[model samples]
Target chain A: MTETWIILGATSSIARAFIRQEAANGSGFLLCGRDMDDIAATAADARLRGAPMAEAMAFDARQPDTFAPILDRAASLSGAVSVAVFVGSMPEQAAIDADPAMIAGVVTDSFTGPAQFLTAIAPMMETRGAGRVVGVGSVAGDRGRLGNYVYGASKAGFATYLSGLRNRLGRSGVHVMTVKPGPVDTAMTWGGPKQPLSTTPEVVARDIARGLAKRRNVIYTAGIWRLVMAVVRAIPEPIFKKMTF
Target chain B: MRWKEMELAGWGRALKSTAAVARPERRSALAGAAAPAIGNRRSYGDAALNGGGKVIDMTRLDRVLELEAATGLLRVEAGARIGELAQLLAPRGWLPAVMPGTGFATVGGCIAMDVHGKNHHGAGSFGMHLAEIELIVGGEARPIGPDDPLWRATIGGLGQTGIITAATLRLIPAKGRTMRVREQRVEGWDEHIALLDSSDASYTVGWIDATATGARLGRGILEEGEISDASLPPAGRSRKVPLDAPGFALSSPVVRVFNAAYYARVPAQGRTVTRAQADFFFPLDRIHDWNRLYGKRGFHQFQCVVPPAQKDALRDMLRAIAQSGLASPLAVLKRMGPGRAGMLSFPMEGYTLAVDFPNRAAARSLIAALEDLAIAAEGRIYFAKDSLAGAAQVRAMYPELADWQAAVSAADPDRALETDIVRRLRLRDPA
Candidate 1:
């Protein structure tokens, strides 16, 4: 069957790698992002790499109004409609501390905005009755840590939303998979001290493809992250509150 | 653009430097860059490195903006890989006009080095196919076409003129996705040169056993290839070297045995076989990070092309290399025609010999000896493979160095795009 993917935040390196992999498999794409120029370049890349139909459209999470055109475009494509949410922003903790106002934008970018967009598109997936929804949460969401608890809390809420959505969408024969990737080597994680256990964007994309194929509900990119996160989640609240990592 | 501070190296892995890099994902983001640009870092030397400075990594911006199938005109971002381009265009009956040895080499790197291929004796260098370039000079993306003064300086100019944002490549027709290869074992230096000179194959190259000495010196396998209509299964999954190998993995004895085994893999009578185009063009890429096999010290490659009259001089260099007992299994000898496209392009009407050496004190001295031999023979060392050539000697090798430097200065008045190779060789200095 022909596949059409609606990739939100398509300019992310991870999203770009995923779309390229999908293009190689002959899927078309609706690359939605705020950076139209960057998104357009990715669409061109997909077309050259073998995507049948690749169109770039404007998408801004803070502006809910921008979501409708992308949905309209996705509706026009033929085949299973898949949606991948790679939209998110994490301001420096120091910046967020200095200006509490920045927290709203971060939460909007990382969580609530994409959730609302997916809610609007749920009916289309139901009408189609065959599609996948990949909501990219982060390992930071697995637990609230001192370093980036604000960002973590936003992703945690998003992950919960995805779980509820999975429960809701499973009945319609539409699958929803939550991806909690560890430190993926991307622009998102560049320049900082290297993560001891980090995987490449390409590897993350590969694992996502595998997870979707198996119809997995939730997955950790490095697999080891599942064990690592389990240990972290198991920590007692008393000690966790006193610790800073 | 996220500016990441990290240590990076050339393909050789022998030389490394810490620098700041920003990999922009779009052409628009490439603006306002006061730095050199790099793609793939496949130059094997400092040509792609900008030490203690800032540089833009173009790999992420790779995209094919346009293609005219009939005219074979392809407009692609600087970071697009050559082998990927071939894979996309081959079934459609088109291929890059020239591809360097590695499939991982990006289009921008090829143009920066003006790289040659096995078909160099016929197809010339990669820059010859360039139609136009989107060059980012001092924050502005300007189009430099064939008629532009900056064109020649940008081509094979080691990323000195500007950041090449995009380029138009004139692809050639490919008969099929596979190539028919003819292999023969050359007995010695004399026969190797004879076969390379006489061969009529569109793509021709010889694998020399740099460890061979005495009568067996320069003995190795010679391969001639031509594209065919035969449809074959695509190349298989590439394997990677998981860890840095021990230093002795490619010791002289090991290299000798490996070379002998490799040479003997071909039947004594010679034979014809078929291979996927990728395998034929980039035989070593199948093994990812093959350089690590030389250990953490990394390796250096000495590649030079001497005029036809200096064939005897080349033999002495080879003899010295064999006697030094420092050669690795990787060595190549090829006949090149005088069909280069840039001022400092490596190809010339001569025999080009490339031999890899594990980074060691003795090997460095041996490489210096080879450099002296090349200069004495009135030959030039390739910028893409050189890590040790002195500025004065290299300046003498390429007569057009002054012309190239002048154009580069005019294009980049502040020298914002000068790379480590430029700084080391003092390429901009007239004297």
Candidate 2:
């Protein structure tokens, strides 16, 4: 059976690396993203790398109108129709503080928008009774810090939603994984201050593949992040509120 | 991110640069400025560095867009590694026509340097296999074909003719994924030259012991390989150089012992062995960050090509290196065909010698003397490996320098694509 992956936010660095790895495994791909040009290039690369089928489609997280065509395309394909959501946005805390309106876009791009798409496609995945859903969240979501709490809050919501989705879909033989990675050396963190123990997109992709193979739920990349976040989450609310990262 | 400030260096670690770098991951993102673009920065010296200016990092843009199975033509991005391409295509019975010594060398860097491989005697330089190049000129993509004069300037032009976005390469049909290699010991300079000159294998290379002198001069191993479909165990895991080695790690006595053991490793009668294709081509790559073996002070590699008639000049140069007691274990000598695709391409009908030396005052002076000898013999130094050649001496070596300069100047009037090597050698300046 051909496993067709409906990759959301296909232009993200981690997503691109993940797509390359899967393409080599002879998987099919429906690459969806805002930048059609970039997605088209990745599709061509996937085809050359041994993907059985690869197509690019327009997808904008802020607009729900773009989700149906992608879901319909996945339904038209045979075999397992999996989806990996790498959609997220991180505007500087200072920028969000200046304009509160930016908060909505952040939440929509990271949480509500992807959740809506997944909610619409859930029945299709359940009917097939075989597929994987990989939702990429950040370690920052484990405990919001002063640096970028809005973005952290969005990922936190997405992570929580994935936990519920996993419970609902696990009964039907589908797997849902929540990946909480620390700062990855991608465009999101490129020019920012040096991130502690920051890993590359390639590393994150490899971790995701390992997590999927093991059928693990809620795994932390760079595994050190799990311990670090554990200590952070244990801190008392009063002290944590007064401290800054 | 659009840009990031960082310090980078070439493979030799002898030259450093602090620049604002923008690593665009997509073709659409590469449409901005006509800045100098660098791939894996595999050049041993400053060929890929631009001191305090801006540079475009093309490593992330690597991808193979298309492969025509019938004609064996591959349309690939500039940042794709040569080794990765071979690994991807070999199982399908095709390979990039020419691959440099290190598989980590990117397609763009190979084109800019006109790198040669063990098959240089037959397949020629990397640029000779290019069917078309999608070069970013004046912030727009333009396809450059063989008939265009810019084509000559771009290949081996040292990235001065604008950024190379992607290219169409003519891949050759490969027999299999493994190699049948025959290794033999050669004693004395005459036998070494005789063996290299007479070899007709698809891939041939001579590993000379740079520390040997007198009656044993030029004694080392010669490896000739042919692709085969033989089954072999998977290669072992690659090891990494954890830290900088001490100065004595490659000292004269230590290197001599290592060389003797390496030479003796091959039986006195010689033998044929099977090796993975990558293991045969990129032996040093097995040790990740092998450059750290040179220690913190770094090292320099002196590579030069002299016409077949100038054998004595090369021998004298080697003798000088042997007496200096500064040579490292990495040294090579090979015969090249008269096949070059650029005005300043590095290949000619000659024998090329390359030797690595720790960055010391004595090594610096020895390399300078060798450069002068190369000039006297009408030979040329490889810009990709040189870090100390004088500007005027280099200008005299390449007769077509003026023509390259004219084409490059016309392509980049503001000199936005100039690199450290281009600036150091004064390649764009007319006498």
Candidate 2 wrong stretches, greater than 4 Å: none
Candidate 2 lDDT score at position B249: 96
TM-score of chain A of 2: 0.99
lDDT scores for all predictions?
Answer: 0.90, 0.92
DockQ values, each candidate: 0.58, 0.72
Pairs of residues clashing in candidate 2: none
Docking class of 2: medium
Interface RMSD of each: 1.9, 1.3
Task: Give the best candidate by DockQ.
Answer: 2
What tens-digit string does per-residue lDDT give for candidate 1 at B149-181?
888888888888888888999999988999999
Error of 1 at B246 (Å): 2.9
- Residue B291 of model 2 has an lDDT of 91
Clashes of each: 0, 0
- Alpha-carbon error at B323 in model 1, in Å? 2.6
Stretches of candidate 1 exceeding 4 Å from the true structure: B231-237
Model 2 — TM-score against the truth?
0.99
